[model samples]
Target: MDRAPTIKDVAERAGVHAATASRALNPATRAMVNARTAGRVHEAARALGYAPNSAARSLRTRTSSVAGVIIPDLRNPVFPPIVRGIEDALREAGYMALLGNTDGDPERERELVAAMRGRQTDGFILATSRRDDTVPGSPVPTVLVNRRIDGGGVPSVTADNAAGVHLLVRHLAGLGHTRIGHVAGPRSASTGWERYRAYLDAITSLGLDQAAKAVEFAEAFTEAAGHAATLDLFAANPGLTAVLAGNDLIALGCYSALAELGRTVPDEVSVTGFNDMPFVDRQRPPLTTVRIPHYEIGREAARLLLERIGSPEAPTKSVVLPVELMARASTGPAKPQDS
Candidate 1:
């Protein structure tokens, strides 16, 4: 009664063997035990204030029960929900998340990965990976969230960027916007590249091939970058009636750039954005954008990473979740060229 409650104590209280109690207490092995018996074991452990010694289990299993989650930036407003989903999924499996922010720096990302590996993290869920990047010497499994490599070497969970972009472009074109411009995100990231490529493809398919010339690439997926790129895009093609921003942040920059040029949104220039992140709906004119399931992206990434961790030899897989178009006040019938 004086000493810490042991597995034996828990087992006796639950009328089960010590091994059964052990399996019941562990999330990984809980499925092997009977549901009723596992519940009783859990109840017994809780009643007796029993806590499993994770250190001992780690020593035996060679797994830290922790995952390294690396993201580009937390300020973007889209990543927080994804992170929350990852944490929720991991916690359900008796695992913890070790989070890091890379701020879109490759060197910083590598350093964080190394530090997390040094701490014996079981695997990694990266939201900062570039298209050409690789974890060459990584001994543990890694899954990509919201970003992916050029080829299919690692598992990933991403939204359907191409589909989302095509949807936005079609929506704009349907609004009588033939002269549409694009402010693309950095080309290095898959999200940026896919959306940009999709824009060209969509325009070409719609017989608006000349519209592709009115495009400018942002340095990063940030408001300032979007602002600069939008200005460049407009300077070259001032006749464009609609602007399809690479993402929500970029669309926000369009607002500032258009304002600076004295172009009233949806009157002179209708605008669309992607990743319907956070408060875009509350902007002076609510932004019309593609809605990706941010939280589900994180949860799916966690699921893929856990699958890889459990079965390291399993065939690598990727999940591309669907998206929806959220139409709002920011877009409307394009003004006539003379107007």
Candidate 2:
């Protein structure tokens, strides 16, 4: 190439004025241009391999043009779409995204938060909030995704856990499942704690509280924790007709435990899970789970953080997205033999 492509070059190629080209290339000002003209300018800029100098832009705008995204476990399969949503939203605002994984460790979370802030991130989008989360200290704007801290200090977007659990219990009851069990996640997490409470409320509301002998709590949301908890619950209440798992990973542990006892799912014991995570439908029998809008949750969190970054004095807001029941082959009517 003769010289690095410039805004003038982009304007010449796109047949628009330099001011119009600049507006099209800038995220904050792009909306002021006509859609057709903006599209043409962007296409021309891309064809010429053009990117504005970050040093110059930062000096002029006093912004890093980057956002940090923190997730608890990237291997969980539920975070890819959420991260994608965050990235899409950030890109449209002319900000690059940086990701940090905690692997479910508070110390790691603190280190990552500090590292991102050191890199001059304009804000944070966190997917690792716990019940009493205190890792991400008060600095730049932060938004919690897929998780939240009760009596919230930060903006967050999450699915309605209590309502989702109620839907699951009602479905199982409607199918005649009475001797129901629960494989709950760790109590330290807001999701784990809230979902477990929801399960209790659900059973009590239906007058099935007496049938709650087979409850177990996984130390974490991992498969191993679920497996151990399920086995423990089954040993105590061998005749349980159904189980409500804290999340899909824990439900998988339930599957492993039930398999060891030679129990066929939905025939002897029906299983239900939360989060309706990716590929549960492809399991031995499709899993019946509560569906939350993961991508939308991520997008909402990003928007909230952007809003907070723009206006630091805004009151903290919580966005509770709705959930739905996905009844699949994993649940069935309770057998008469259970009596």
Best by TM-score: 1
Cα lDDT of candidate 1 equals 0.90
The lowest-lDDT stretch of 10 consecutive residues in candidate 1 is 130-139
Clashing pairs in 1: none
Per-model RMSD to reference: 2.7, 3.3
The digit string of per-residue lDDT tens for model 2 on 170-268 reads 999999888889999889888899998999999999999887556899998888999999999999998799999999999988998899989989898
Q: Candidate 2 regions off by >4 Å? A: 1-52
Residue 334, model 2: lDDT of: 86
lDDT of 1 by residue, 1-339 (tens): 899999999999999999999887765566679999999998898899887888988988788889999999989999999999999988766689999998988888889988998999999998988888876227689999998899778999999999999999899888888998999989999999999999999999999988888999999999999999999999999889999999999999999999999999989899999999999999989999999999999898988888787677879898999999999999999766522
Best by lDDT: 1
**lDDT agreement with native, every candidate:** 0.90, 0.87
